[model samples]
Target chain A: MTQPSEKALVPFVSVDNMMRLVHHIGLEEMLKDLADYVEEDFRRWELFDKTPRVASHSDVGVIELMPTSDGEAYGFKYVNGHPKNTAEGLQTVTAFGLLADVYTGYPVLLTEMTILTALRTAATSAMAAKYLAPKGADTMAMIGNGAQSEFQTLAMKAIIGLKTVRLYDKDPAATAKCAENLKNSGLTVVSCASPQEAIEGAHILTTCTADKQYATILSDNMVGSGVHINAIGGDCPGKTELAKGILERSDVFVEFPPQTRIEGEIQQMPEDFAVTELWQVISGIKQGRTDARQTTLFDSVGFAIEDFSALRYVRDKVAQTPFHEDLDMLADPDDPRDLFGMVQRAKP
Target chain B: MTQPSEKALVPFVSVDNMMRLVHHIGLEEMLKDLADYVEEDFRRWELFDKTPRVASHSDVGVIELMPTSDGEAYGFKYVNGHPKNTAEGLQTVTAFGLLADVYTGYPVLLTEMTILTALRTAATSAMAAKYLAPKGADTMAMIGNGAQSEFQTLAMKAIIGLKTVRLYDKDPAATAKCAENLKNSGLTVVSCASPQEAIEGAHILTTCTADKQYATILSDNMVGSGVHINAIGGDCPGKTELAKGILERSDVFVEFPPQTRIEGEIQQMPEDFAVTELWQVISGIKQGRTDARQTTLFDSVGFAIEDFSALRYVRDKVAQTPFHEDLDMLADPDDPRDLFGMVQRAKP
Candidate 1:
């Protein structure tokens, strides 16, 4: 029997392939590109179908599913966050994602999302600050400067034009490491002792603490007016960051309301609490920060569309540059009906 | 410098390894063992954390996420059903899944679920038949026999003592293909012309049609009293197999009620419509087939726990075999904080 000439399956982006792309492109340029992808997707929001993320929680950590579609393609990310894992020598977060064609339901790409997720999270923050923060915001106070700190600095510098960084972590070694990494980048980097000192006079306050409990990283007194608060931690049920007062004072914008409501700072507020979707702001369908003195809060719990956008960017880059391995994952059968034939034909 | 020890990396069960497993165990033994695994998992349903599958719908088809945990471990499957693709010469459904350690939140096994899915779906049906059908029930009318027919036949013979299967499909070629595949089995097979002729005098009725639209493969008038209906195909927003009368007349059993409300025959009913959970029945918390002469329905839209059960089974079996591949998907640094070192240490 003759088989129809089928379209060649796309190459899969693996963990090493993605790392090579980052190394080749330079992390700053890649983060900026990823930021651009997020901004571009957010601007054309109406062309996509959006939904809140679904999560399954346990005592140690949580596994989440974030799914979105750009009308033509569908994507989702599976990520797990276990803060204590760092002590056990495992990264706090590990992820993988899939991109499928909506027309044919064929999975076009499956890529390691660990590094991609880090880049996208930082990119999303930078994208949000572009419209939500004051124009030409220069200095960012990064609280809890750990594994995610450098990416945020790179993204903000490459995308939002940051010139200075103030770092603070409960562990002084982490702050020293952050400072050492940013020492020769031509940007002025300062190590602070307390959260209060970190946020004294910064244009953006990025809180990405890794604590799994409801601990307040930022109080109302520390956050000044006109600063964009990028709340990245407190993304699960019982985990939270910013004090209730910050949420009350700021104009909060979220990726998806239903999801951020449960995972973001809004979890502390009533269900009727008002918020703006970042896509709406990007699409110009809704307003962002109303004035210069208005404190804007981007309560980001990370959405799937950003990951989808990131995946597309990585897939495109992988094609242009010679980096990637075919995963040998998809079962390509000669006869679609005879999936069992694959086993029967295999040589022992 | 020496590369970090490989103790942190997780093992991957690639499609090649899965095919090798099927060849080593042989299809019949694998089907029978998978059926036992599913049956055992169902009986201990109360021990599992069950939730409705999350579904994302599109104009072309629907993609769904099915996740479950048994306190000890968690598993999830990413599956898509685009029935129209077969006409376009693509498989109607394709899937892959992961089984993770709930305590540590690390993926212990990742397996190609396309072929395994076919094996498990048929096994689940036979398991349902074993409990719901009468003591001497030896015949089943399999309507819409396509990719799933042979496994259904073999699983029934292996698990439920089904000695005969009256097969019928709108396409005569499909019916012939099914008979040809199952010719050596002990069960006597008959290819019928229509749904009405197929179900006539049969002890059990199973429907596994593949369409994204509402398809009434079994009508109200065609079903007889004391018949156990295993409805397997109607698994998305607009897809359904049984007539409304069939659902109303039968004692309906379902896999997670919220999910069944969206994907099964019960989707046509209201939010408050009554249905018994198959898990509850299997756990003896509720009853299965309350009456000997009353019609009963197993609205099997497919559940995550069964996949979880199968994943555990496959992962355990694969661990015992030499066929394995190292995906190298995880990022491990001697110090988890030295993520930056990963790039610097890469031997370019």
Candidate 2:
């Protein structure tokens, strides 16, 4: 049997390899680097191809393909959201992503994106907070401490010099788990009994509860002036995290208006309700936070460009370290047109 | 490091394993089986989620994601087409696909689809020929002999009892390579110098050329009445094989009209051009080949449902054989919300 050529093999970072890569890079440093990458992509966001994710919805959950390209490299992530999966001891969201060369359409990297998504989502939130949050913000109130809480808190610490995180979840066990996970992460972690206590003395507020319906994790009264709300959880048509009154008061900013209009907190607003594009703020085309007294909100329903940036970052990092294994995934016959001959020759 | 659980493992059929599976089943039998699967999906096409493939087109090539689902299982293929890749010793097209359980939103199978694509394409052509070709068709003229020629020839032999295949290509070396590959496939293979010579006494005509732009492989004068034309290569915008005159005379059948209108041979015709859905014909909702003197054309640009059916078929076949490996692709933490804890514990 002939060996597959170099072109036939795609570098794959398994879940175990991803964990090792994070450890090797140090989690805080990785978060910082991911934030840098996300910010860089945002600065040049006009070059990317953006679309609302293609989703196949069922009664139980939804599966989606999020694809984006930067003219040179194309990337996509296949992710599934089944909130009920947690009860069965499975990850509620599982993902894998690919990066391909736009010139050749050949995949250069394939990686487990469940961990990567968590990392990228946090990085995106932190990057947005850097542009939208009050200057020198050092504390965050993390409501809905599920799979994303620890990462979100750590990303804030990494990017914004946040020194404190007050965590709260409807389930006490979830809050306890999050607090336990962040105990050694150099942050002052506080477990709060309720959402009101979580926001006490915090400059940034993050809401990321995983529910598939219209549930308000943060009501208008729960919010105050001058705080940046990093909303991450309400990412489907009927799912939202903030009350309509809160959105009406805050200076809302979004990743892509078309997508955020369908899946973000702004879905509660009228069709013509105003919002700023984060890319415009990052590029200085528009303002982020107008004044110290006005509230700013980063309504982040994760977008494909963020995934594209994450995949590109991983591809670069994997090439620098021996953390990826080559998977024989493509059939490269000696003659490109003799695919049948190659199969025939492989017969035993 | 802890071992990933069964839920984290997705069954992966690598290129080598896929080759072994094909040889284990015998190529002709596999083609016949694939045709059966394609036919079955066509019979119930209304149940599928059909959309034209989502493509990111660059100056050099195009990368696309083709996704479809029944109510139970979901499948999608990541494929790229770069015409200049063959000059760089790369396959012009390479693909990989995944099948997930819609109920759980978990991936069940991941397989390399380049080889499977060739087989499925041939099977689809043969299946269409079975319904649209003249009765007792035993001879086929395969134009533009390339990677797909041998498979197309053998599939016809297996499904429609084709006894002979006359092959021609603009490049004689491609024709020679195709003829050499099909020598022992129990079909009388003839090498012709031109398209007119290839179709001299054939009842079925297949045109599958791989140029990225429109080029007439079969002109109008070369086509005869009462013949079934299986046009496979004109699958992208601006890339077509059959002349406009041939299409005007033939009773055109398409896999999906919306897709065919943009990417198939019918792109030359008007928007409201009369065509029959192949699925309708297969399901007996519409007629195929109403008379012996009528010219029949199957403008097959390929569809997501065909790939979905192919993935499902491979998943079932690999389940009964040992020709597959388990890939630990998903991060299955002990507690779904404790993903951060899982990563922290993996530290050395």
Candidate 3:
């Protein structure tokens, strides 16, 4: 058997390789690096081709393809959101992504993005917190402690200098698991009984629950002024986390308006409601947090470009390390037109 | 290292496996089977969720994601088209696809579709010819002798019992290569100098050229009444093969209307021009060819449902054969909520 040519193989980062890569870089440093990549992409957001994710909705859940490109490179993520998956011992959201060269139309990297999405989502939240959270904010109240809570805690500590994380979930077992995971990470992990108790003295409120419908994890009265809210879970149509009153009171910031309008907390508001594009804020074209006394919200419905950034980061990082293996994914016939000949010759 | 559990693995059919599977079933038998699957799906087309492919177009080429789903299963193909790729010793189109279980959002199969797409496209074109071509049509004139020509030739033979294939290309080397490949395949192969010579004694005229512009491969005067024209090369916007007068004279059938209006041969016709949906004809809701003198044209711009059917076929076929390997592509932790813990435990 002949070895596949280099052009026929794509670098694939598996789940174990991703785990090993994270451990190799250390979690906080990886988070910071991911945040830098996310911020950098956001800063040049206009250069990217953006479209609302193409989704196929079913009675049980929705499967989506989110694609974006920056002219030179293209990326897309195949992700699914099934809130009931955890009940069957499966992850609620499972994902994988690919990064390809636009010039050659060749995939350069294929990676398991379930873990990278967690890291990028948290890093995106923390990056927003750096711009929107109150200055000198040292504590974050994490509502709905699921798979993303620990990454959020570490990202805040790495990017925003946070020292404490207060966690709460409707399921106390989830909160306990998150707290235990963060125990040795140098943060003062506080487990709380209620969302109200979790946000008592926290300067940043992060809500990332896993419900598939409209459920207010944080009410208007529970939210205070001069704090940033990183709302991560209300990411599909008819699914929301913050109360409508909270949205009315806060200066909401979003990744992409068209997508945020359909799938974020803003989905609860009127179509004509005002919101700021986060890219504009990062580019200094618009204000993020106008004043310390104002409430700010980062309505983070995960974007394709962030996944693009995560894929880009991983593609670069893995090239410098031994965290990838080549997979023979493309069909490269010796003569491009002799595909049938190639197949015919492969007969056993 | 522990082996990945079944839930964490996706069955991957690489280029080699796809070729082996094609050989195992025999190419003509596979083409017949693929055409049957395509016909079955087209008969129940209303049950499918159809959308135009999501494409990212660049100066040189285009990358697209075509996604579709029935109520039970979902599939998507990631493909790129670069006409200049052959000049670089690469294929003009390369693809891979995934079929997932809608119930659990887990991928069931990932297969290289570069070969499969060739098979399915040929199958689709031939299947349409079975319904639209004149009864007992035994000869075909294939205008473009590229990667798709041979597959198209074999499919026409399998489905419509084509006895002779007359091939012609702008490049004689391409025509010669195609002729040499089909020499022993039980068909009378004729290599022609021009498109007019290729169509001299043919009842089915198939044009599948590779140019990206709206050049006329088949002029209006060259096509007579009662011939079934399989115009496949005019798939993208601004890339039509047949002259407009030919379309004006023929009874046109298309896969999906909105897409055909943009990318198919009908792009040259008026927006309000009449055309029948191929599904209606397959299901007997609409008439195909009413008389022997009526010219029928299948303006095929490959639809997502066709790809879905192909993916479905490969998924079922591979399960019955040992032509696939498992890829560890998903992250499955002991507890779905402890993804961070899963990473931490992998520390070296």
Candidate 4:
């Protein structure tokens, strides 16, 4: 029998190419679909090998590598968080990731993760909100409006029918930009002077600030009885958003306990702090938003599995479109031992 | 900041492009230069934040992510080890890696590691041989010639003056092919049968087998005094080369102990096994090859820092070359926060 034809190569989505994928798919469809992938991956959380990311701390920022494997597939992302970056006209965090076949170790996809991370973070927030927020909740109060502001706004609109958004930032220009972008998106946008005004009568509170120290954005006195706090900023050992009083009094939820205890809002709490993993809630192993008046909080430190899901989703979507490019990811030698021969053959 | 100019985009070295780089650099000089980088990094080992790689294990093989950072630069490699892949016409191990600016988390270089790894590993072995082997070493006994054979041969020639090489493989055809390729390299090559025949009087003994088990390629009795044994196989948990008596009788050196303890030939030893780190020797903190009468072993398990050096070298070399491609690896928005707006503009 003749040898089988060579398999089609894997597609790659670079940073520019991924933005085009987002433009082609439309942000709303991408976020709504990404949330589904996140939810589904969370439901099968037991199938994955999970670990807190490996981080290298510097005087200015912390660079980290997050990796995970689902037996047959493997993925990892390289990311950095430097709040001082924006002053230099750079992103606070820029990232990229790779997807590989576990059995052969060939990288099938490599894509820019700056935009993708923002998209996945928002999708993950909306995903947790779907389970922890009161059904039919349509208004969100987003504090710390910066690069991540629009993503949260779009995800809320796409996944939960969010119709009104109240925005707040220490910088007024950020809030103005957020409000301006929300125009004609079928959402009523309001700019708030302070965190107190942003939270007034809103169904969800999303905090995506870029501070590395413990500075409470929300106090016990400001939280409503039934509001869901989507805490995304307090994600390092000493960084936090909610005061200890708020966390001690609310129904707390987190992504991974081992990591959340050290990086999420619970990082401010005692090591024995009580919390539930989002997967537990998704699996129905535990209850979420038990009563209409009970408060809920999702401490998002950004897990590896979320990136895994997002990479796979974008990897699939971009392949079907012409937006993706091909990356040189592995070396295929006729005789594996002849690595030198491969170079020799290229000689002029 | 007139749109940050598309010309500023970071370029990527895909598998196809990386192969071109190796071919352009030529095998001998590439290995020689890679060894220089590895040697340089090892000299400044204290500057880097290092950790043992994080791995996910499966029945077939294991996949690992190795990450390291030197405050300003960050790097990681994705690699796998599967001894049975040759039956399927695949390399027993395949890999790829990236190097990024730690300050911005922007990946500046995305490269193929399958060929690069072979280059680095051989350079590393040749590096250790430089320090631990007898100063006048010119003949090397190579056993289990497979995917990594050519790399080992060339690296030894480039770094350690390996003018005579005795080759042995389970498949005689593999040994024959290795000799054919090195016909014009100004080296004397020999094809031998059995580990005993290959090791007769060579000054260096290199076992680069791909079997992922504990089978001994060379027994302690076969090792001559003053010969440096470069153990290239047995990188993961259940694999090794020299028998227990061999390590027990020799001064075993390693790349990183915590990692080598789990993946190197020394894994068969006790947790308290005393092995000098190669960096110490490179840094002049520890003695290497104290006497020709002593049997020495270099336990080689690849490290992430070496990849960092290789990546930096390739990136610098590519920047000087005329044959390079742009990959658009960054997402620098006119306003960084307007990543969402980029999607809107990408539309016709």
Interface RMSD for each candidate model?
A: 3.5, 0.9, 1.3, 4.5
Q: Best by TM-score, which number?
A: 2
Assign candidate 4 its CAPRI class.
medium
lDDT of 4 by residue, A229-325 (tens): 9999998889998888889888999999999998999988889989988999999999988888988999998999999999989877877788776
In model 3, where do residues sit more than 4 Å from their true spots? B1-3
- Candidate 4 lDDT: 0.83
Off-target runs (Cα >4 Å) in candidate 1 are: A1-10, A132-136, A195-201, A223-228, A237-252, A266-277, A284-296, A341-343, B1-8, B193-202, B211-228, B236-253, B265-276, B284-297
Off by over 4 Å in 4: A1-10, B1-8
Give model 3's docking category. Answer: medium
2 against 4, candidate with superior DockQ:
2
Query: What order do you get sorting by DockQ, best first?
Result: 2, 3, 4, 1
Cα RMSD over interface residues, candidate 3: 1.3
lDDT of 3 at A312: 97
The residue-by-residue lDDT of candidate 1 on A37-110, one tens digit each, is 98899888777777777777887778777888997888988888777788886777778888888887777787
DockQ of each: 0.39, 0.85, 0.71, 0.52
Model 2 residue B248 CA deviation in Å? 1.7
**Model 1 accuracy (lDDT, Cα):** 0.81
Candidate 3 local lDDT, B22-92, one digit each (tens)? 98999999999999999999999999998779999999899999999998999999999988888998778
Can you tell me the DockQ of model 4? 0.52
Compute the lDDT of residue B249 as modeled in candidate 3. 94
